[model samples]
Target: MVERDRLIAALEDATHASSIHNSQPWRFRLVEGGVAVHLDPTVTPRTVDPVGRWALASIGAVVANLELALTSRTGRAVVTEITLGDSIPEAADLAGGAAYGEGPLAVITLGEAAETTTAMTAARLHGAIKERHTTRGPLLGGPPTEEEWAELQAAVAWAPGIQATPASEPLVRSLLSLTARAEDARQEDEDYLEEIQNWVENEAPSGTGIPRGAIGAPDAEGHVPIRDFTQTPMGSSGDGEAVFFEDPPALLVLHAASDTPVDQLRAGYAMQRAMLEATALGLGIGVLGQALEEPDSRAAVDGAAEESFGAPVVVHQILRLGHPAGTITYAATPRRPVTDLILD
Candidate 1:
């Protein structure tokens, strides 16, 4: 197989990467000389990511993983471009062609992998892409070392749309508080809660939605703070369990300059880069959007009006960094089959 083909095969293995409801809301198009990706509107999660921004971000992260795998395996890559749009479902003339539906997120021209053959390093990192899982189990230990924190910050440079800020103790605490508040706000509304409940109950056969086991045990208080994937009767149901993660030593919140779909995708791309880098350093990372998932929390975190900096923090994903208690196995989350996603 060619490099791109090999990379596509690697996607099958990079299953541990995060996606919206595990919808895998992306489609790949093989061109004569390059590849294209499209969002399958039908596959999107209505309740969790209504606007599809989160799903697009997740797809972008998948794209980043694929690039890393290709570079490691072939020592070179040439992306040229990444087009994004609600329409323009397939190929288009980028040079002209009405700029091809608003605009694309990016067009990465793959380059020769470092001649020094970081292949060993890249291979290990790439392998971790599949091994990495967002564990919600209680964190047993503290944050990574100062040196380790620096490494993760450096990894953020590789992400396209993310500006990662290390959270202070106050900031971290504030986010947790915000999370609790968001959970409360969500539960208070019957319509919203019911919608979330429906999503959790359905098990998408194609491996395109969140699996029941992926949620770990539920909250002992009878609530799933995140998406509440178990709200219905679709899978093997179970009771809640006590889980907690103490004040994480280090917290990184990924932000995008804009909230557009394309920008969201870039943010996702950045997330994967940071994630694999953290994995390579033997750090455990978890992505949480509780604070950014709801409007009130979003306003609190955005801080756009305060203008601490000229830019606002969109808070695409929140990553908690620390050491793992032990190896944790995740269920096989489904994905829409490649055949179902391919465009002629």
Candidate 2:
């Protein structure tokens, strides 16, 4: 039987998983033998993620961390089954309203595996949980060594419905242009600005939202445009000298066979696993969600993915990978306490 205390500890670690804008939109319930991960609709970034793609992906990252934590402890692999639009009792909807268009994002069950097997599986990756952070600062260095790239490729191969394709230099340049256009479009929408502002609290006491310090200096001349969360001066890190991404940064386009909530969840699982694997390989990682957030941009990315993989797939996430410039330090983003995330 899974010990409740052990499960709680794993859940706590899972809370450290990455999310869109650090929204951290997830709730957990200790089920019969495992845990159910739900999207906290009230906290969901409706403006930026109206379809809940990013939110579902964030939930998958949490599941990845939870499973990793459990296996590290029990030496047993965890099983995750994602169900979309599964209805929940009115009383149980933490958002206090109809659940988001698609009800719960996923229900992860702890599966049976020998402790030794699980331990062996998690031994190499266990340290990445704490070490991994979404790097928004300027990325230096050339690219991942052949072996490093191979390890990253191997990490997400087990995720069933996701595909990762490295973007070529020409493709990366095109994506950077598309991302700028998408971000400019979002900037013109006042309502979208208002919604995003709510999560950019410079002095957020709850320790769950994006802090100003976490926003890296924007790279104006760089190929990709990092989201400017500091437009309002919410104590965001002051803009520094414009850094240029002269060499093509290591980029990966993550896509799914189909564009569905469940597929998005699987994409999230693959993304987090790849990020952690990159961390283990001493690579800094950042996400370019703008490229896949809006309709036009998303379609463009889909075209890029289809061309790169020679298959029809829906792009879900774009990752920027490379080594951090010099010894520049990156502060960890804040997360809500595990106590606050648990649903009774």
lDDT of each: 0.61, 0.74
RMSD per candidate (Å) reads 5.6, 3.7
Clashing pairs in 2: none
In angstroms, give how far residue 174 of model 2 lies from its true place: 1.4
Candidate 2's residue-wise lDDT over 50-79, tens digit each? 556777788878888888887876667777
- What tens digits encode model 1's per-residue C-alpha lDDT throughout 220-242? 44222443444432332457766
The true-versus-predicted C-alpha distance at residue 132 of model 2, in Å, is 1.0
Q: Model 2, which residues run further than 4 Å from truth?
A: 85-104, 115-117, 202-205, 233-239
Cα error, residue 200 of model 1, in Å, equals 3.3
TM-score of 1: 0.80
Backbone collision tally, model 1: 14
